[model samples]
Target chain A: MVKSKSWTMVKHFEGLPKLEDFKLEEKELPPLKDGELLLESVFLSVDPYMRPYSKRMMKPGDVMIGSQVARVVESKNPAFEVGTYHVTNVGWTTHFISDGAGFQSLPKEWPENLPRSLAVGAAGMPGYTAYFGLLEICNPKEGEVVLVNCAAGAVGSLVGQIAKIKGCKVVGSAGSDDKVTYLKEIGFDEAFNYKTVNSLEEALKNASPEGYDCYFENVGGNYADVALQQMKQFGRISVCGAISLYNDSVPATGPYIQTYMLFKQLRMEGFLVTRWMQRYPEAQKHLLKWIAEGKLKYHEHVTNGFENMPAGFIGMLTGENIGKAVIKV
Target chain B: MVKSKSWTMVKHFEGLPKLEDFKLEEKELPPLKDGELLLESVFLSVDPYMRPYSKRMMKPGDVMIGSQVARVVESKNPAFEVGTYHVTNVGWTTHFISDGAGFQSLPKEWPENLPRSLAVGAAGMPGYTAYFGLLEICNPKEGEVVLVNCAAGAVGSLVGQIAKIKGCKVVGSAGSDDKVTYLKEIGFDEAFNYKTVNSLEEALKNASPEGYDCYFENVGGNYADVALQQMKQFGRISVCGAISLYNDSVPATGPYIQTYMLFKQLRMEGFLVTRWMQRYPEAQKHLLKWIAEGKLKYHEHVTNGFENMPAGFIGMLTGENIGKAVIKV
Candidate 1:
């Protein structure tokens, strides 16, 4: 028998989730059954989707839903051998048990130079999301201008870099000056602190005088409305996340975009990373090659200790962290 | 030399367009040069796009921009012989001299049974808008549910019928009970008067218990926001127009759709009919076949005389026309 610690939802989040909304509890696991494997969580991921999705899909007293990179401690399943790393949605847990179903084993030849924590960060779901959303949804062509909101965060950072790699002029908006600087350092053609800008429209117009050909939407609301107006004819928008509205106590409202969308012939598509589940390995391989070739870079804002998961999650929602927000147990 | 009477924009539209905003002026035509043809306007189109686009694209002294089906009275060009009809964006003109630069000749073999006015209506831009917007953008599969707003209008009416032809259940919303009846008579699976519905969401839920797989948005604003919430996972939206906000005195605003779109993994694309210009003849052939086989039907609300053009335009904007609104000259 092994003792495992986990965070459980004690109450449904009303607006911004508080630490009291979750309860850290302990459970004693019985011996694993024949196809089961015991997992020890190495790093847990906290993302924007968890906030709104919890209110919609989760019930009180349920194990909080999240993804993590874990090591196989004991395995009866040959597919998930002991000492191999795997990514699983085992929530905010220090340990878990899985039957190898819904578990993705890390590539056997994962470059030793890269951090294993990337299984939950870049080179993982966030990386794959930026890959497919930009390449597939936006289908950006070389010499086109691409704009990303919430840049310096996991997905947005990767989106800008990937657009650059594809020969696009990349512009990004971040919440802080440090983030703006970081984005510029990471090869964004232009980076602005959205919070300090007098007008988002002015900032965007100044950044890309010709207008954007592709928009990677992460921070929705008024920002999205402004961005929509600045899009060139036949532009494409990938609606990945709406972090600005995830914790809204009131229903979110913004300037109607139909008129602009219609005249410009814009295509705005909303998507989840899971839509490309079948092609995960393909994306993973390309992302790995990009990283190894020095064409891609990744950052992780990691908080140590399992007990600090709630704080880490709250900080991420408030834009307190740059890059992928993760908890190292 | 011949005198041609034309409507010219005297002032930009303030709220809703007024008759005095345009000046009916007569101009003496110059002699046709080689490759030029003399055109006599037969049918002029009055569409929702004219209202907003006029203000955006037209200068105060420019002719009111519009498309018209014209008879080639005298042809210096071999391609456009006398008595042949063609569609040209010659504005609100009773006669014009065109060099055939932007003119599309009507199909060489005219269906004697179908009205020639259709060359500017159903068989024209509006019809093709519905065809490509639904089939290409929404891509409705068999057994799916489709919903169209402004359902009795030209594009929306065609959208519902096309969805039905594709083996999808069709639900529609129109402004009046008569329009609803017209939609049902045209083979819509379900139709509703949006004004009478206590709750649009409830109306949608009752109409499509399984939720919609595709949404053809012709009316935007509160209706679009409500329809978005009723969409099933992985639904597609084809945004053709937004007549609801065309004459808005204030900027239009609606509920933020990013959260719903993200969770449902929905795709909403806005398009102009011109996007399918390269494949126009292909779509026109399919539409003509559907009409000839009686699988597709068309209705036109025609206002007589060229002078009634403004009234036709105003009436259409106010939802007075049941189908494609046009003016017979």
Candidate 2:
């Protein structure tokens, strides 16, 4: 028998998730059955989506819902041989027994120089989301202005970089001055710290006076309303996430955007990354190529140890992380 | 010289528009120039769009912005000869001198049985808005559930019928019980008076137990928020208007819809009829064919006389009109 350490939801979050909401527990795993593998978590991802999704989809005593990069320590399954790496929906467990279901093996030709943690961070779910959401939904054209909020984080960071690669004039908004500088360094034509900016409308006006053609929305609420107003006619908005409102106990209210959307003929679409599961490899391939070409950059804000999962998750929710937040197990 | 009677915006609207906001005046038209034509108004359209668009795009003393069907009384341009009928942006006017620019002549092979006034109503901009917004944007599929608000009005009425023709289950909401009955008579699978319903959410849940696949949004604000919650994953919303909130001096607050949209992977697009200008004839041909086959029906709530333009427009905005609202001058 092998002992596994896991974080389980002890209580549903009320406002911003508290450390007491999650409990670290140990479980004993039996020997792997035929077609089953024993895996050890290498890196665990903490994303903003977990905050709301946990409340909606999970219950108390359930393993905290998440994705992780794991290495097969022992295997009875022929499909997943021992010593292979995988990206799996294995929750926040340090060890798991799986039948290789809901898990994707690390690409066979993954660049040797790339870090293994990237299997759950950049070049993973967040990267794939930014790739498809921006290209498929927004379809930014050359010389067109593109705006992204939560600009220093995992998905938004990649979105701005990808827009730049597509020859778009990219503008981004982050929460801190440091993030703004980082976003500017990563090819954003203009980056503003939304927290310090007196008005997002003025920041947007100063950034792109002509108006944005495409908006990759991560921060919804008032920011989205302001962005919608500044959008050029027939603009497109890819609604990826609403990190700003994730922890709100009460629903936030702002200017009714449908008015601006109608007069401007704007298209705003919300999407989940899994919608493009069939085309995952397509995005992964392009993302890998971009990374190899030095056209895309990634950053990981990793919390060390499996016991620190709750801390990592809480920190990510409060915007303490600069990029993809992960717990190194 | 001809004396042209026109309504000009005397002051900006405060709450609901009043007769005092407009002034009826007469102007002397100069002799027709080489490219000019003289038009006698036959039918004037009163629409919900003019309520907000006028405030944003027009100035005091400007002619109340509108579209009208007119008979060409005299013409110096060969493209438009005397006796031809045209739909032009001549505003609320009894007679006007136009340069023949931005004017479209009535279909050359228009059926004699169809009223020429339809050139600005059912078979006009409203019809085209419903066509492209529904077919191109929402793309309702066979057996899909489609929900349209303001279902007895011009665009919403047409949207429900079109969705039915596409083999979708159509549900609609209107303000009055009479309007709801009219919607059901026109092939809606279910109809409800939103004002009578205990809760819009409960109404929607009862109407579409499986959840809506397409939403034709004519009434924005709270109605939109309720509809967004009941939309199935990957649902589409074609936003045509926001008649509900058009008259509000203060923007009403509702549930921030981005939360539901993201969870459902829903797509909501706002549109103007002009977006489909290139494909106008295609939609017009289809609409005309449907009308001839009796698959599509249109009702015009017309207030006779040019002086009733304000009344007709106000009535349409307040949900008093059953279908396409127009004025016969």
Candidate 3:
């Protein structure tokens, strides 16, 4: 029998999700069937999308749905061998029975001596999200100005670096001075701490004199509106996520932006990475190549132990995590 | 000698625009030099973008700028002969002198079947605006749900029809019952009069069950918020214009859609059609071909008399005109 400790949703939230909403449950795993394998969770990803999506998709009394990097310990399935690393969206469980489905076996030919935790991060889904979102949707051209928020984080960091590789001037906005410094270190031409800024519009105008050509939006609210006022005549905005108001008790009712969009004639689009899942491998190939060439870098804030998953998740929602927030099991 | 009368801006409006804001002045004819060609205005194209952009780009007491199709009545240059038509950004002038290099010349090949007024309306900027804005920015795929506000107007009408041609189910929202009917008649899968609807979200929920994949937003405020909530995963929003909140004195707000963009992982883009000026011929060729094949249709809300251009503009702002608002000077 495989021993497992799982974080199950014991309650739901109205505003900011609380730790009490989750319960630490202990369970015994059954023996692997002929086609099944026993896997141990090595890492768990805690993302902002899960919070709102859980309120709608997942219910109370269920293991939180999330992606993880795991190692197969024992297997009746020949495809998943012992000590093999695989990436799966298997939620917060410590051990799971796998039937060799919904799991991608890590390639043996990956860059020599790469960390396995990144299989759930930069070299994985979020990296591909930034790749397809910026290149395909935003279509930033050479000499164009590209701005991305959460600049030091997983997706934003990759987005800025990718734009830099494409020969575009990259600008980024993060929550702290350290994060802002981190963004510059990663090749961003301009980076600002939104927290220290008096006005987002003023900050943007001060940074980009001709206005931003393309914006990869991850943070919403006043920040988006501020960027809106400083866009070029024909700008493109890729709306990947709005982290600012994910846990809002009320709705956003500040200055409206629809008029500005029409006046500037800007284009804004939102995307789910799954929309390009068919082209996932293509994105991964480009991203990994960049990584190998030292053109792309990623950071993960790993919260030690499976018991700290909820704290890791809440910290990410509050913009506390520096990069991709993960719970190391 | 060329005689001309042009409307100059007399004052800025505090609220509703009046006749005093503009003053029509006739200037005595100046003899055309060797390189000058005298032109008479035949058609004037009026649009919403001029309202706010003028406040920034144009100073008070300057001539109100607009585009018109003018006939070269007399010319001292060999480059332009009599009976040739040219489109000029010559403002509210009845007659002017051009050097033939300043304005775009309209070809005289197909004058019999096509309307000359189309040079300032459908065959010109607004038509191409609808074409590129809908196709390039939105990029709607087959079986996708497309929502267009101001569906009976020039750009939105074409957007709905083109979306239909692209195999997307289109829903349109208009301000009046007549416009709603017109939208339905123009191949819109569903059309609703927003004026009669009690709640925008409810109407959207009723019209789009599977959720919207592309939204061509012309009217903003509550309408935009409602449409945003209805967007599916990875939805695309093309912000063309916002006629709804243009005249408001206070900052606009409603629906609080910041969280929705992130939740749906939505993408909204705003674009000025003029950004594709270098590619105008490409879009024009496609639009003309669509017209030739009867795949596209358009309407012009013509207001005759040059002196009454302000009246038509005010009416269009109040949502009275259905289609491309223009003045037959």
Clashes of 3: 17
- Give DockQ for candidates 1 onward, in order: 0.86, 0.85, 0.57
lDDT (Cα atoms) of all candidates against the true structure? 0.90, 0.90, 0.82
Candidate 3 off by > 4 Å: A109-112, A184-187, A285-295, B140-145, B161-170, B184-189, B205-208, B255-258, B263-265, B278-299
- Top candidate (TM-score): 2
TM-score of each: 0.97, 0.98, 0.91
Residues A1-329 of candidate 1: C-alpha lDDT, one tens digit per residue? 89999898998988889989989999999899998989999999998889988988889988889999999999998877799999998788888888978788898999999999888777999999999999999999999999999899989999999999999999999999999988988899999999999999999999999999999999889889899989999999999999989888887887788888888989888999888999999989888898889888888899999999999999999898889999999
Give TM-scores of chain A for all candidates: 0.98, 0.98, 0.97
User: Model 1 segments beyond 4 Å from truth?
Assistant: B31-35
Best by DockQ: 1
Q: In model 2 chain A, which range of ten residues has the least summed lDDT?
A: A115-124
Docking class of 2: high
Residue-level lDDT tens digits of model 3 in A1-329: 66888888886676788899889988898877899989899988888778777878787898888888899899899887899889988789899897978777778776766677777778888888899989988899999999999887778999999999999999899999889988888889999998899877878877788899999988877788778778887788887888776677677677778777776767676677887888888887888888888998778898998988999888888778777888898
Task: After the best TM-score superposition of candidate 1, give how far the Cα of residue A155 lies from its true spot, in angstroms.
Answer: 1.3
